[model samples]
Target: MIKNYDVIGDIHGHADALHRLLARLDYRERDGAHRHASRSVIFLGDFIDRGPEQVEVLRVVRAMAGAGTARAVMGNHEFNALGWATPDGAGGFLRSHSEKNEKQHAAFLAQIGEGSRGHHEALAWFASLPVWLDLGGLRIVHACWHAASQACLAATCLDSAGRFHGEGLRKAYRSGTPEHLAADVLLKGPEVRLPSGHSFRDKDGHTRHEARLRWWDREATTFRLAALGLEDRRSELLDDPVPAECRYEEAIPVMFGHYWLSGRPQLLSPTASCLDFSVAKGGVLTAYRWSGESVLSNDNLVWVAA
Candidate 1:
């Protein structure tokens, strides 16, 4: 087990920024892999898509993880890649070859050469990544880290070796099933449908019907308060906080990425934090250096300019 960890946020194929962040963390490039003398990286994932150097990012990260200097959890992009590539047992892909999924993955495909041998190998590797990581003192997920969701995946999606592959993996991505919801909530965070007659344009200017909630705020009692942690536009969002029964109530030192947070970085809660700072969208790539602390501090946060 690694004694110290530099929990990194979503890279989204920003390899240059990832390298800069590693340099800031005192990691040195050695023997073709990034290494820190006494520390290892726990990547929160989203290493592909939306950036200019998708394949290079994969090369660097895969090399580090292969050298045992880093560990990574599967992010939503990686999961989507698997789903998009899998066979539906009929005619189409497991995720359905739609324009939406294709557009979302265009950047990645552009850099990696869609349907090339390298792309297929990368997708195969992505299929083997675990959806979450429990490192005793530190817990990491791409988005929300719910115990129930973790247990559900463990029982339904995980193989003996803890990989999300084969039948279980496909089942987890199949929409409308309990397995799908569990995986979605864990990978994409908890979301609630906007009330009838309510809608909002996201940061990308796409109209969103369902909104991702602030999973770290338990006392957000109004719409503005509840939307405090959302990464998208909030001006048109419903001014309604989620019910108390739906909020995250844990005090564990959990760290996740995926929210395209901007501006100054800080803990989402005393023990909960988001590592993503929207590096793919010209925001900085961030990381939270952790060493057995139950309560996190903003001082531990690090970043590299996008």
Candidate 2:
């Protein structure tokens, strides 16, 4: 079990902010003779894409993991960014961002084609990351572990072989058709559904017919926590619970990234916390420390400003 650690939100290539945040958290280079303490820093993924310093973020995290100072879960964006194939391939996360990331995209393509040791090593590292981690009475993931994925989440368990499977999913993502990964899994943030013929409700409870992905509608936003016992081809909107089927029998709080939390670097959900504060967009990259079962203890958290 991970004893005392800091769970950091999505960094998104904000190297400067990340450096500052790490310094504030008391993370330092270990002297060669002295072994570092047992403390760990858990990054909630999204180490690349949508920011200027993807390479820097990758280098730092790789160093930190090697030094045993940190561990990171796989974020969808990282999966997409690292899984880029041919430039002419169908639109994947990498393709979608390539327009804005000319230099990084070119560099990534060259590295992948060269099939050098560094490329292979980086892929191996990404492939080895876990989808979720349980620490300090808290369950951590890139996003929430709703009921539908509970079985997979439980089976994968930690940062072992299970992460390879997530990597496999990434490879599949590169080849599969658009929307193949499903909107709920590929996109960050919660999920909402409007019936084929129905409308989404506003904050004032006014409903309107709008055909958009679940993440686009703010007021009508819902969480897709689990899958119903229906065929995969079935497009019926199911009333699944938000943060569904998380029994919390262990009474452990959960920490996750993937959602921007309205561009604010703060914790949401009194029970399950989301720490992605859009640091790549000039916001803050946040972290929180937890000891016991309670999540509302401000005293238990440590925030490092960007």
Model 1 lDDT on a 0 to 1 scale: 0.84
Q: How close is candidate 1 to the true structure, as a TM-score?
A: 0.92
Candidate 1: regions farther than 4 A off: 221-245
Which segments of candidate 2 are over 4 A away from where they belong?
A: 31-38, 86-117, 153-160, 166-190, 195-250
Pairs that collide, model 2: 137-252, 148-226, 148-227, 191-222
Candidates in order, TM-scores: namely 0.92, 0.67
In candidate 1, the residue pairs with backbone N, CA or C atoms under 3 Å apart (3 or more residues apart, or in different chains) clash, namely 223-239, 223-240
What is candidate 1's lDDT per residue for 125-195, written digit by digit as tens?
Answer: 78778888888877889998777777888897898665785888888968898889999989998777766
lDDT of each: 0.84, 0.57
lDDT (Cα) of model 2: 0.57
Report the poorest 10 consecutive residues by lDDT, candidate 2.
211-220
The residue-by-residue lDDT of candidate 2 on 144-169, one tens digit each, is: 54434534433433234446454345
